[model samples]
Each structure stands twice: as structure tokens, then as C-alpha cells.
Target chain A: MSVMIDTGNYIAAKAAVMARPAVVPAYPITPQTTLVEGIANYVKTGEFKGEYICVESEHSAMAACIGASATGVRTFTGTSSHGLLLMHEMLHWAALARLPIVMCNINRVVGPGWNIWTDENDSISQRDTGWIQFYCSSNQEIFDTVIQSFKLAEHEKVQLPVMISYNAFILSHTSMPVYVPDQKDVDNFIPKRIPKWKLDVDNPITFGNIILPAAYEKVRKDMQDSQEYAKKLIPEISKEWKKQFGRHHGDLLELYKCEDAGYILLSMGAIGAESKVSIDNLRKEGIKIGLARVRCFRPFPREEVLKLGKQADLIVIDRNISVGMEGAVFTEVKAALYNNSDAKAYGFIAGLGGKDVTFGDIEKMCKKVVNGKAKQLEWFGFEGV
Target chain B: MLSKDLVEIVFHGRGGQGSVTAANLFVAAALKDGNKGVQAFPFFGAERRGAPVRAFARISGDEIHLRSEIYTPDIVIVLDESIMDMVDVLKGLKKNGRILINTTKNPKDFDFSKKYDVATVDATSIALKHEILVGGIPVVNTPILGAVPKIFDRVTLKSIQDTVKDKWKGEQGNKNVKATQDAYDGVEVDF
Candidate 1:
């Protein structure tokens, strides 16, 4: 492995190329443009041996991916904000049909206000799309997860699509030194996609045809079964990667100082990384606060959340809201602990519209809960709860 | 949190001044110096030229886990001195922090020299002298990086020259390295 100093998008681009995807269909968008550009550079330099297609729109990009992936070849693509939202329908199609397509979605804020900054709304809004969601905090994790996603997605036990999300500029444009493993090692880690099924012209078969209600329900149930299997397989793959590369960013969840603590802070993306500073500062002040950075949002990690809830109170700081309801993670975490454990969890809506959720802001939220002064839910930095 | 081993620096310049590249290249040099952790990123918004822009970098003796922007910087670099007119370049500088500017005048000319350590270099003139022009405008990012090694001991002028050469090859690379050397020699500091 060699250390490369560059931005997150470029590192992810190298990882994607190293994974050796057969086809890439991409469209440009803010914060996501550099990532695709990096891939194109690799293709021009002959490092990438794939059919790189320049699609018209975000919709066509995913459609092209679906078309290529249905042929039983590995496929990868990336986008952010509106681009990911535009592929909403195809996202469902890829997952329902069990294509192991992998993508990187830059976590940018949704529009109408025309703001292009870091927020989790883009990927969080696609929660029910049946894709395995992974939120990464560091460029190294982005690099590792992009490679690992292909392995996890294409696993026989879990043949589902994967979406790797990182904060817009906080991660997407940030430069850090990431250790790029040798191609031989990466190829050994992620072998060619030996799919169970595919479309062949010689032995033609129907794909995504109309189905009856009973068959459709069975498909949905099978997806759930695969997700549960994914929860078990994610850690196994992560462990193997670590054994090979001497680096692992955790699987399902990355815990920081959470072995024994009364209060545990919960978050994802860049804020999850910044929470370590808050935890360190709070620990110095005699607060037994730990951090459980949610790495995987689905299969929801209910078993893990239940375990954490049984141990300590959870304070969730979510960067995405469900409009009329509270923060998305808070809603789900509370449900995980409902009647299952006696632990209490508080929710704070923050970083929406790409507002800076600094370590100071995170510390303030944790202090409120530690002092027994927080409500069930509050909009951070807003006038009222 | 003022962790003793970490140093944060913010850069101020115009849209086309390469402030973002300055941070990136500067941190790359620091990484070569064997620092365990380094980060560089730009405060991105609109893409209008001549608008005040900012970039940030951090150097640490250990691995860096914090991902927030540097709220309080230990050093500030100004690629375009005129940016001071519209932006507060020293918004959150630490006490006795250093501020480097690309100005023709001596470091004593700036009132900020009284409070913070000041370093001045004619980076614009150096870029022009080496004919480093992009779209017919002097590119000061590389020249200012030359002065960085003078302030931060962890980064060396040799490392910056090597990094620049790796980014731009042949005649372009030689021109940037020579411009960097000139800026390093021309820097005047009020310490």
C-alpha cells in the first residue's frame, strides 16, 4: 500500500477503478463533479478498463447502470443531491431486481432554496429504497467502503445495491492521506462478480416482468431476509479487509469509547467524526459520554441499537428531518428501543441546510442531556424546541 | 480544543488566486515531512472570480479524527492582499499567531504586525517574474507556498519544490519551482 494525498472524490474514483467495474454511467452535479472527473481521467490514462458512458441526465445515468448491471457485470456510479434524487425510481429497480450495483452519493442538501452544502437529506430521503446505506466519516473510509460495497453487494447471501454517502465538502472535497492498496491485493479482496443470474441473448430470459401480488410480496420478504443476512456479512467482510490491509473503518457501526459509559452520542457522516473531539473534551470534564457512529443505516441495526439502548441513553444528532416529523435517525432509534430497553434517547435536528455542526455545537447538545436539561427533540440553534 | 500537537491554518484569496490549491499543496508538503495527520479543504460557495475565498489546512503529530472546519486558526495566508478590504483575514487567529501576505510593502507597513507575527513576500511579483500566468493573470498560489516553509518548520522549501514539480512537469514545473525559490528568498518577516 502507498499513501496518496488527494481529495475524497479522487480517492473514491481510484477505489472504483481498482474494483474494476465493467460499466460507468455518470452525470455531473455540484460537489460530485470532481469524483466523476477523476474516474474519467483514469479511463483516459488507460488505468480503467471499462465502458465509460456519458449519459444525458441523472435518470439516464442510473438507467444505463441498470441496463449494464442486468447483464451480470459489476457496475459503479456516483452523484449528489438532486442527481441522486433523480435516480430514485431506478434506485428501487436496481435493489428489487437484486443487482449488485454500487454508488457513492455525496450528502448535499436538497434544493428549492438553491443551497449546495453538506447535509444528509439526499441519501436519508431514500431510506426505504431497499439499498444498503453506508455513511463514511473519512476519506479513507470512503475509499475502503467503495471497494467493500462491491464485495458486500455482490455476496451470494446479500445480492442488493449499496449507496456510500459522505458529507458534501466536508468530505467530498477534503484532502487527506489515504493508503491505496496495491491493485493485486484489491483484486484479491474483490474478485469478479459471479452473479447468480443475468440476461443472456443465447438463453434468453425475462427480467423485471409484471408479477402477481403474492410473488411481489415474496420478493419484498426475500429482500428483508437478505438485509438481515447483510448485517452478519458486513462485519465478516470488514474483518477480512482489515486482516489484509491493516485498516478497517468498522462495520455496521464504529464505536468510540463506548465500551462502558452512561451517555452515548449517536450520529453519522462528518458530524460523527467531529463527535470524537466532543467526546474527548467532555471526558476530560468527568462526563462518561461515548460515541456510536452509525456506519450502516440499513438493515437499520436494530439489534445493535437495542444493545446500546440497554446499556446507556442515546443522544441522536441527525442532519436530516422528515418535515412534519422529527429527525429520521431519532424516529428509528426510538422505535428500536421502544418496549425493548429502558434507555432514553433525545433528538436534535442539526446541520440541515449545511449549517456548521462544530464540535462546540455537539458538546453543547451533549451537555444539555447530561445535565438533565434537554427535551425529547429540539432544532439546534433555533429559537424554540 | 487547543490540542498541543495540532496546528490549523486558514488561507484567504480571490476566486482565481488558487487559495484552495495552496492549502492542498501546503499540506502535501507537510505530509512529506512525516506528520502523522494532515487535512486540506476549501470553503466552497459560488464560483465568481475576484470574490473573497477561503481554504483551510491542519497538521497534527497524531492521526486527526475531527472533521469540522478550523474555527480558530494558528496561521493565516493571504495570496491577494486586496482581500483584506472585504474580508476579516484574522477572524479567529490564535494569540501571537502568524499572518503571511503577498504585498510589495514591508511587514512593518501593516498595523496587524503590532499584534501578530507578520511575514510579507512579493508573491505576485515573483509569479510575474517567472511568467506564471493562467488566462493572462499572475498565479500567486505556488509563490506563496514558497514562503510557507519559512514559517512552518515542519514544511521545507525543498519538499514544496518537489511537490510542485510532481504536479506540473517539464518547463512548467521548473518555472513554478524557480518562482517558489524567489519567494522564499524575498520573504521579510517581523518576528
Candidate 2:
């Protein structure tokens, strides 16, 4: 039964988290702290089982999570932009060790001059870390994806860390209605599946040992193969999530109204919701436009993304920039559609450092891109006027 | 969209103003009258003193479908006047929505050029009379919550009472309940 309960997004996240259950190891940071507090609170109240480590820093948090997961425990943690940056070095270890850890990344803007708002730069910065990444638009999606992340990560074919990202203040602070499933239902659906290579005291196993150059390529290739396997396994797990939870996730990459449309706007995070409004308004005004929300950014849904650009003029909007280069998403979009002769990709860099990318900005940008006059690396709604 | 209608109100205030506690009171009162409701605070950036924050309440007979921010808020209670200047607080207010401002000054003293109805209450004075701490930041949100049912007659006092009892249980909670009651009794309603 679908019950629409009006809950704070943070509370919903916390409730879903408690139900799924995890041994949390997290440190507090702006925008992302409330989530940490919520999880910590649960641990303190004995509502959730497992050790809650008050780690020194983001790096230690990931390390503690790695330790917990390696020992065959369901582990979880969270961090934001800079904290994710600190955990960068440990991400490689977790992926190499193939620990099926789940993490919540409250996506915030990375800075040259210290700013704490919202952006995808932090998560996008670690695109090559071999962790499966999912971007959530709504609070409900955040709750749903966390449940699915575990299933996807723990699968035999793909045992890797998963990071679910949502814009820090936008979705994190913004209150919303979240439908929480019955705890019994979640347990029946998620059912604890310990991996084959679990750390057992009776049978000791070394994890993340120093690799010699001779065997490094094989180890790297195995990691690569696991990621490729995840590309397929994600759908299988999502299928189960739908049957149990009644939420059909479109694909690794979800396209919104792109069929037969002349122009398409590509985005991730909360911006996708805004783009929907822009698309609807443009449609009313006789403009054929659509939105493509990148649900899974890592183990990138290459084929689906390429196909999205096939029938329409593609405009890629990335909240995170690649410094010196255009937005990282645009580069990936271009790479996806490189061989597709029919598709032309336009890049729209927007919402850096918590700047509110309004529906009006999206409409204006789409108009320019469709007319073939939009500049590459164009910052949406930047004030010059 | 039920026959009675779902009006999701968001109250923006600081930590000490009793915004969250007041919101709980409102939800309690609504639920007592058998109206389904919810009250929740935003994922606070920091619970530091004098920091801007918000809490929400979704009230209706039927379940709520709209999980997003109440973009077109039916009612906006600003406990702190400074919040109005900080953000576009009135951006998506419904045409006929009401804004209750808790301040020491009169309604005319503050700008109300917007088309919606603007009401002001000197909650500081009422709170002072009750010997409620008035030296620090004022607990204007409680009085505002109490006075709101009068402005929006659809909201019953009994519902607020129920929500308060269900949510807030301690002496502090009881004090808030009584404070809300005093606020309800003290509405001047001079428009």
C-alpha cells in the first residue's frame, strides 16, 4: 500500500536508513551534518544495531566503513564536498577490496574560495574511483536508492562501494513528503545477503595488500570487469526494487519526454525537477523540448545516454565543472554521442556554488541551445545584466 | 485534493523563537480534531542560536501527495522580521494567502505592498506578560501559532491541543502548550 506521509526529507532518510540498518562511521559537515546526526541519533537510541564510530575525519570514516564491511557487516556513512575530497584516497582501497559499502553524499559545491551551498562537483570529482554513484532528485528517491544501492553493491557480479548523491541544501534542507515502507516489508525485500568473501575469524583473509606491478594489471582488469558487471546488475536489482516498493526507476539514465522532441536538456540532481517545469512551459509555447536526468553517473549508462542524444539536439547541464574544461557531464555526454552522427551536444554549466538555477534560466538556455547560438561552457543565469 | 483541502504551511524562524515547538502545537491541535497532519523541521544546517531555519506542517483529511517544498504556501509565519529581507519569503505565496508577522511594531510600519493580506502581532508584549523569557530572542512563534486559527478559521484549537500533547510531553512541552493557549486568548485582530 502506498501511504503518502509528509515527513522531513532528513527524517525520511534517517528512517529508511534505520530500517535497512548499517554500522555507521561518519563525521559532521555543513549541509551533510544533519544526516550524520540523524544516523548517530538512531545509533545512540539503540534503534539501530552496530558500532557508530565518531571518526576523526572523512578519510577515517571511509576507512572505518571499509573495516566494518570487510568483516561482513552491512556498513554505511555520509559526507559532503570537502569531506568527500578527504575520503578520496580511501575510495580506491574500498573499491579494490570490493567491499559492498553504501554511502550518502550530500552533494555540495567545491571551492577555490570556501563556500558551502549545493553542487555535484564533490561526487563528480571522484567519477573514476570505481564506486557505483546514484543521483537522487526527491527525498523519496534518496530513501529508495539507498535500499537499492545495497542490493546492487552486494551482488556477486558487482561488489563495490555505492555513493548516492543529492544536492546538499536543496534536497537536504527542503522538506518533502516521503512514503516509508513498513519495516517488516523492507526486511523481507532487502533480506541480509552476506557476500561469499566475507571476513571470518575462522578463515582469515588479507584485504588490500600491496600489489606488485606484475599482478596489478590483472587486479585492475578484475575491478574494471566488476564495474561492467554492475552496469547490468543495477537493472536486475532495480527490477526487484520496483516489484517490492512499487517505484519503477526508468533506467540507469532516465529520459523525461525526449521522444520526438527537437531539443533535449540533460541534467542531474535537483535541477532535473526544475528542467521539468521549463520543458512543460516550453511545450505549452509550441517548443519541442525534453529533459534527460542522469540517474547513475558512475559505471555510466553509456548506451542509454548515447541513445538519448539520437533523435534530438542534446544540451548537457552540469552543476560541477571540470576546472579549465567545460562541465564534466557535457564532456561525458559528448563522449557518449561521439560516434552518433545524428546527435549534436550543447553544454550548459549552471548552479555552481549554490546559485539557484531557476526554471526561467533553463527555458532561456534551452531556447539558445535549440537555435544553435548557445555558447560552449555557457554559465546559466550568471548575472552580467 | 480532498473536499476539505490540504494546506501545507511553512514557518521560518530562528532556533529560540519556538518555531518547531509551535509547529508541533499546530499539528497536535489539527490531529485532535481528527484531521491528518504532519510537522517537521528542515534538515538544519546548524542549530546555532539566531540562525535561519524552517519547519513544515501538512494538514488534510486525505494523505498528502505533494512532498516538495510548499512553493505556494497557504500561510507563512515569519517569527523573525529580519528573515523577510534575507530571502524572497513571499515569492510563491498564494494570491489569497495570509502572512502573520511577529514584531514589536505595527503592521503599517513594515512594508506590505504585496497583494496578500499581512497581519502583525506584538508577541513580545504578550510573551512578556506571561513572564516568558523576553530578554533574549522572543518566543513569537507560539503566540503566532495560537492566533493563526482565528485568521484561518478552518483550523480548530482542539487539533492544535491534540498535536501538542502527542508530540511534546515534558514540562517544557506543557509550557509551550500553555504559551500557545495564551497566544490564542490574546489575539487583538485589528486589520
**What are the Cα lDDT values of the candidates?**
0.92, 0.74
Q: First chain TM-score in every candidate? A: 0.99, 0.94
> What's the CA error at residue A183 for candidate 1, in Å?
0.4
Off by over 4 Å in 1: none
Model 2 over residues A129-162: C-alpha lDDT tens digits?
Answer: 9898999877677878887787788877788999
TM-score: model 1 vs. ground truth: 0.99
Model 2, docking class: incorrect
| Poorest lDDT segment (10 consecutive residues) of candidate 1 chain B | B1-10
Query: Which segments of model 2 are wrong by more than 4 Å?
Result: A1-9, A12-16, A19-22, A210-214, A382-385, B1-15, B19-76, B80-97, B103-116, B125-138, B149-162, B181-191
Candidate 1: give the clashing pairs. Answer: none
DockQ of candidate 1 compared with the true complex: 0.79
> Best lDDT goes to which candidate?
1
lDDT of 1 by residue, A1-385 (tens): 8999999999999999999999999999999999999999998999999999999999999999999999999999999999999999999999999999999999998998998998888899999999999999999999999999999999998999999999998899999999999999989999899989999999899988999999999999999999999999999999998999988787788889998889999999999999999999999999998999999998788888889999999999999999899998999899999998999999999989888889989999999999898999988998532
Give the Å shift of residue A248 in candidate 1.
1.7
